[model samples]
Target: MSYMEENLEKYADPEMYDHLHEGYEVDLKTILKWAKQDGPIVELACGTGRLTIPMAQKGFRMIKMDIK
Candidate 1:
């Protein structure tokens, strides 16, 4: 496997990744605004649904994908 594939589990740990990215999701309003204007969104490496959930909650259609 590639190095990134081997390390996929680490990135897939929702709790661990969320904790590590504690204040990293600062684009809530920005994403919401854009999604409101634009159409659906596709988020790559959407770890833990951190921003995805909120965006969906705000009525945006999002497709979240990840290595896991």
Candidate 2:
């Protein structure tokens, strides 16, 4: 497995994972926004950076990471 994949193999806790994803403010509009721009951002243990993604969509660079 990739180093990234290996590291991320741990955030797989169903209960916590579900709750985290449930907390993000995500939408198609936001994704579209990010698709049009570029900058630097990192969603460490990202679990869905509801805000991070939208911001990234709005033309910022970003990297996504998760802890296993």
RMSD each, Å: 2.7, 8.3
lDDT of prediction 2:
0.62
Error of 2 at 26 (Å): 14
Instruction: Give the Cα-based TM-score of candidate 1 against the true structure.
Output: 0.66
- Runs in model 1 deviating more than 4 A are 1-12
Taken over the whole model, the C-alpha lDDT of each candidate is: 0.77, 0.62
Structural similarity to truth (TM-score) of each candidate: 0.66, 0.39
- Please write out the lDDT profile of model 1 over residues 1-68, one tens digit for every residue: 88867877567567887898787766876766556626778998787799988788877789999766
Task: Output the TM-score of candidate 2.
Answer: 0.39
The C-alpha stretches of model 2 lying farther than 4 A from their native spots are 1-39
lDDT of 2 at 11: 62
